[model samples]
Target: MRYNRNEAFRFAFKEPLHARFSIYEVNGKEVETTEGEIQLMDLSPSGAKTYTELNIPYTANNSVKITIHFQLNESTYNFKGKIVWKKVWSDGFMYGVSFLVNEDMQQEIVKQLKIHVKSLKN
Candidate 1:
């Protein structure tokens, strides 16, 4: 299947899953590593939509990347990506992280996601 640069197919879990993330990059400068908990709303091989109570400011034109770590079926996974979309709220925020991964890594993620889905159905 052909991939689209502006959009990606995402998968949603039957139950809520939480993950930890830390600021990895900002305009190529080292950061203090602001870390927080994020609820996984939906996931794709290349990106994810997440919600968190911690406030993360989105900057236009500046490169910002985060390292997010989560587990599925007892295996740990991580990715570094920038926020491509955001929705601010009074108490929390929703952000989309766009990860740049190789095709092999992408396949691994898809394998893990498939296992997660099967477990939920059982």
Candidate 2:
């Protein structure tokens, strides 16, 4: 859960979400649109850890759109992530998701994360 850039925001949600990237999900799983799901772990803004799988659609520097649902209080926010990095591991593939653009929901998450960071700094 480390980022190369400290400017990236991190927020936790109350629940796990079903995310669909601009790529595609095969058989209700996350993967390259044409391929199958590759095991993933160690998620963060900068990168993640994944197991070895063939046809790893995403590359080290490929740009991707990651969509995940986020909820806080009574509001639910949909997130679109831009890929930063992807790495290969003996176990699987690790990936990174970056926020794409500004939306009201994203702004709220950013605001909250900023406050959280500020609190930590204090």
Q: CA RMSD for every model? A: 3.3, 7.4
In terms of lDDT, model 1 sits at 0.79
Candidate 1 on 65-105: residue-level lDDT in tens? 88899987888888888998788855898888888788888
Best by lDDT: 1
**Against the true structure, what is each candidate's TM-score?**
0.85, 0.45
| lDDT against the true structure, each candidate | 0.79, 0.46
Residues 1-122 of candidate 2 have per-residue lDDT tens digits of: 23435545444322322233335432335654432343333333432233334434565445455554443344555555555666665566555655554566455765654554465567
Which pairs of residues have clashing backbones in candidate 1? Answer: none
